[model samples]
Target chain A: MNDYLEIFNLKKVYPSAKGPQTIVQGFNLKLRKGEFVTVIGHSGCGKSTVLMMVAGLSTITDGGIVLAGKELDGPGPDRGIVFQSPSLLPWMTAKENVMLGIEQVFFTAEKEERELIAEYYLTVVGLADSMHKKPGELSQGMRQRVGIARAFALKPKMLLLDEPFGMLDSLTRYELQAVLLELWRKNKITAMMVTHDVDEALYLSDRIVCMTDGPEAGIGDILEVNFPRPRDRKAVMEHPDYYRLRAHLIEFLEVHAHKKKPASTVPAASPAVAVAA
Target chain B: MKETLRKLDFLLLPLLGAAVITGLWYFSSATWAGDLPNPTKTWTESKPYVLDPFGKRGEMDQGILRFTWLSLILVAKGYSIALILGTPIGFFLGLSKTFTKAFDPIIQILRPVSPLAWLPLGMVLFAKVKGVNISEMAALFTIALCSMWPTVLNTAVGVRAIPTDYMNVARVLKLSRWKTLTKVMIPATLPYMFTGFRLSLGIAWLVIVAAEMLTGRPGVGGFLWQQYNALVYEQIILCILTIGLVGFVLDRLMSVVERRFKTA
Candidate 1:
């Protein structure tokens, strides 16, 4: 199948107080229609920067990102983004937050239709009972669920998630992971999620892209997760290959994590050679 | 047992102080002015005023209620007008960084100017209006103008303080301008707006009396000034008390409304 979303030699250089910080260099990605791709790396490996670029929140530096045969421009309803924070409108109820995005996508939708769509998505995210509750009233997990509902209700062609479950507790994280997996399977929407958790990347994604750290970060490796569909958390964890993949990603992370950081002392002339540890 | 005692302890000093002050006032006035009414006499004189401030005594004008109502009306009108104008302006100024920069210096320059300083200008402006007498609108306009700053500043601050992520969510959803204003932005900034409103209203209530003194509007402040000129010491004190009580009640009302709307 033709790649629905393609990144060719994409790079991101952020201008900071000190100098231009190159977040991604020679980074490339190809996404199939309705594919779930998870990218995992240590903190500050440009995982989020990559997602932000794809979502059109940030600009690509060197090359380009194309979606459905068109070059990406700015944020559109066609690409929904869920940040690490809940980012729900605090003044709005869970239902209203979902309706907000739904209305945007279907601008001419009738009031009843909007409400119904909002209700439908809220129920899908298991927030049926708490529809009227605002973000302040709802628990963090519940708020995140509202965020998820709002994103999905828009019915975007692509979903970009940046460390969504990073702040959630272990139990809530696991539960949300299950919900995310279920939604992805049911809808088969193209999703790119950035996570630090190896287990999440292994369980939720069809393929995992591990990113390196910056001044110049790039995709170090891509591992296809050959797990079965409708994966049960316990059963998936008990799979023999699970630990092996987890350890492999961990080793990859460990080696690159330290080497990625600009060394405190002046390094030898060739930084790339020094990175070979 | 200990918690109950601690709570009582919190009330002990203020209560004791109040008692001491009352005792001192009762004794000092009795010693200084032999004809000075004691608390008992003051209470007796005040009974008719309390029961029915409009009840007339022979050759004495019973104008307390009328003055109190007039003062309250001016305060309400001035404060309401300020809220109507200041709220939206503050909200927009708060929402936009450029707008805030454009307007902040003007707001700061105007905010510090005393309301009393504007009274003469207000009287001058309203003096020539065709329909109503200049005196009546002057106090109202002065209170409105003087009390305007707090509401505007607070509303702007509240709007600016809103999390940028929340606005991003609204943008992502492409909420209509009206929905963004009414549903998202206003509700989020309500607590701050109300807090400013409370402060502004208090200022309006405080300033109107003084403004009325200059405008000669039939308010408690004007009445107090009139009674002082006439050497009606009791009436002056009476007007002062009335102003304090009414201001307290207005503040409490705003507080109640604010509490109802405040959410987690």
Candidate 2:
């Protein structure tokens, strides 16, 4: 297969009242077909900003994002993004929300076909019982499940998740991480997840991109998670590499945790040693 | 006992208050001999008028009931017009910031103006409409114009209050503009729009009666004025009671519609 998604020098600079603020710079990554990549960063490392740029929700001030070998334009069906919050439409039932994206993407599909697809995906995400309930009625974890179901229902080539399980309790987050892993495996869909949890990154990703602090933030290091498939959370944590990867990510975050860079470091990628020095 | 009392609370206060007011009116009519007749006499005289205004019962004219019906029709016409026109305008204003910015100031400026101020303009314009006499249309024109503001303002506020995340979902899902407006925006904004509708209905009912009085049209307000001149205190009291009852019913009807939409 092809490189499912390629980000070359992706950057974002937002105009704030104080001055120009750089949110993400020199954000570069490549997702091979069916590969799952998780980006773990401290708060304000621009992890979420990077996801938004890829999703086409936010503009990229410089560089380019290529998805399935085509330069990304505006929002399209090819990229499905689940936000930090579930962000499901409150007025629609959970099933309807999933069906909405499917109907739009697969416009020529008949009504029965659309319903079947929506039902299939909702069951996949473990929301089969919540198909008729509105977002408000669902628990925080359930709502995020609906969001996951909606995103996956579209069958996008690349799934973009911005802290999809961050709001949930520990147990629910674990469950959803497992649910996401299964869905990703079953479909062999490429996904790039932005999260703050180190263990979560190691649990779910093929490669974990550790991000440092920003005004000028980019990947600090990459850890290739070579854990075996159908990964058991209990077994995975016990694996020696899991703790090693977790420790490396924790150390990177602790040193750069919420540190504001001086003006000089706020530009595009300088050498790694430039910041480290 | 506490639960029973809570359930009874909805009906108890209003019914008891109505009875007390009726008792006071009965006593006042029994005591006062001047131009104002007792509540009983007013009711006795007005019963036939309400039931069969056109069918001649006595030599005394049924002009009062006729005027009351005219006012009711005028208010209905005006409020209906307001509902139809204001709802769509409010929906659009609420949905689009561009529309809100362009129209909000104009609505703000016009909304606060007294509906009474529109009376002379209504007379002047209706007089020029040719087929229908200006004098006949004045009450409705004034009522409709006065009632349009609340619906418009309420609708816009509701539209603006839609959660930003909801809008983002609409964008992400690529819902057609038509679908968004119908399935999402309208249903979400219904409560606010109904609030505006109820306010406008009450305002329109009040404004139409007064406008009818001023315009000399056949309605409750005009009938009350005419009855007051005749010095038949009982009939005057009857007309007043009739106007209040009609206005209350009209307000309740609007609220019922609002409630149905709420539950839906």
Candidate 3:
């Protein structure tokens, strides 16, 4: 596959009192044009850090990221991001919040055209009626929808999502995942999302890059998800290989991925022993 | 009927408090403070000013409302200047650590100095300028200088307190520095800035009274001083009441404006 986006040996080292603490090292990935990839790992595994580096929101201490044949530097409008929090400007209405980025990216466009662009994306995200409402007035799910719309409105060469639905309830998460997939299908934008949910990674990504536990986390394994395009939720769950992939992911997380304690460590006492004590 | 009674209680409670204060004042005037005029005597002697608020007998002897209006105009001028100057200083103070470090000590030191102290400096500075009302200029300068600290401090605090999430969004959008300020920083900091403005206006109103008295300008404070000199204690009380009422109204107006901007 053509390397539309390449992250080569990306590393992050934060200085601590003891010494330089390397959170992520030897991290590398490549994405083809219009491909959807998800980085899955436990909490604090530097998955988001890796995504942040790729988006150019965080400084890379070592290595490099090249997107669409251009070397990345500081953040630019070429890469769109959806943060875990909606991050909508509270003062602006949903349409105005979306219009903010649209104005920046499409500066040469007419004012009415920009307004229409904001309106159209907000409408597509199922916020047509509440397009004029501020983020404070909207539900958490609706606010995230606006965030998704804002990212897509930029029409960036790459889309980076840092645990975009990590804060939502399961139902809201499922609904937003559908909304995201629908938008991705239409735009065919090269997208990378960092998530902790196994089912979410399974449903949305073409490939899942799992990271080891942190304090120097690296790619532990990569699983290709070739469940075919235009995937229906029910069909994907019912596929013959679905249980196999699910068990494989669960096993990696439960058994192989966690930091092992030394054999000299003693196990805790039973409930009765604690009560007697 | 119950809701109406609750609404009535809101008005009634304050009225009761005022009546109690008035009763105590009357008792004190009738007993220990024989020189002090009773409320009834004060009302009777000040009736002409109350009845014809805008009446003008001479330049300095105008009706009480005219004096109050003059004070308000002075305060408005000074408050506008304060906001105009203080807001940008506040933005810089909040945005740049170096700027804050260099100037913050000076601002803190200057902020606590009274408006009365600033008056002589203002007079000396305005005395050299040509073709302007010197006393008015000095009064305006003193008022502006005294009132600007709150706006500057609150604005700096507000700008510094902006959410990290918003800044991150600015980064991802690749917003220009100008766009980041206008679209993100300004809007986010507006509520706090208005809080500063409201406080600044209150300070301006407060300083105007003292400034006017020292400047001997045609304002409520000047009228109060003039009444004291003329030995018309009732008129002094009248001027005091007028100043309090106008200050209350100005504060209410500012709070209304502050609420309108606190959309977030």
For model 3, how does the per-residue alpha-carbon lDDT over B6-30 read when each residue is reduced to its tens digit?
8899898999999998999899999
Ranking by DockQ: 3, 1, 2
lDDT of 1 at A162: 80
Tell me the spans in candidate 2 whose CA falls farther than 4 Å from its real position: A258-277, B1-34, B50-72, B95-98, B133-136, B249-264
- Top candidate when judged by TM-score against the true structure: 3
Candidate 3's DockQ: 0.67
Task: Name the candidate that leads on lDDT.
Answer: 3
Off by over 4 Å in 3: A17-19, A256-277, B1-7
Poorest 10 consecutive residues by lDDT, candidate 2 chain B: B55-64
Compared with the true structure, what per-residue lDDT tens digits does model 2 show for residues A1-277? 5677999998888788999988778988888999999988765568877887788777889999998879988677678888777878776899988887898899999999999999998998888888999887999999999999888989898898888877789999999999999998999999999887788988898999988777768888888999999899999989977777787888887677535654345443222222111
Off by over 4 Å in 1: A59-63, A260-277, B1-16, B30-41, B44-48, B55-60
| Cα lDDT tens digits for candidate 1, B125-155 | 9777899867767776788888988899899
DockQ, all candidates in order:
0.40, 0.37, 0.67
Name the docking class for model 2.
acceptable
**Real A-B contacts recovered, model 1:** 0.50
What's model 3's lDDT at A88?
94
Better of 1 and 2 by TM-score: 1
Give the DockQ (C-alpha) for candidate 1: 0.40
Worst 10 residues of 3 chain B by lDDT: B227-236
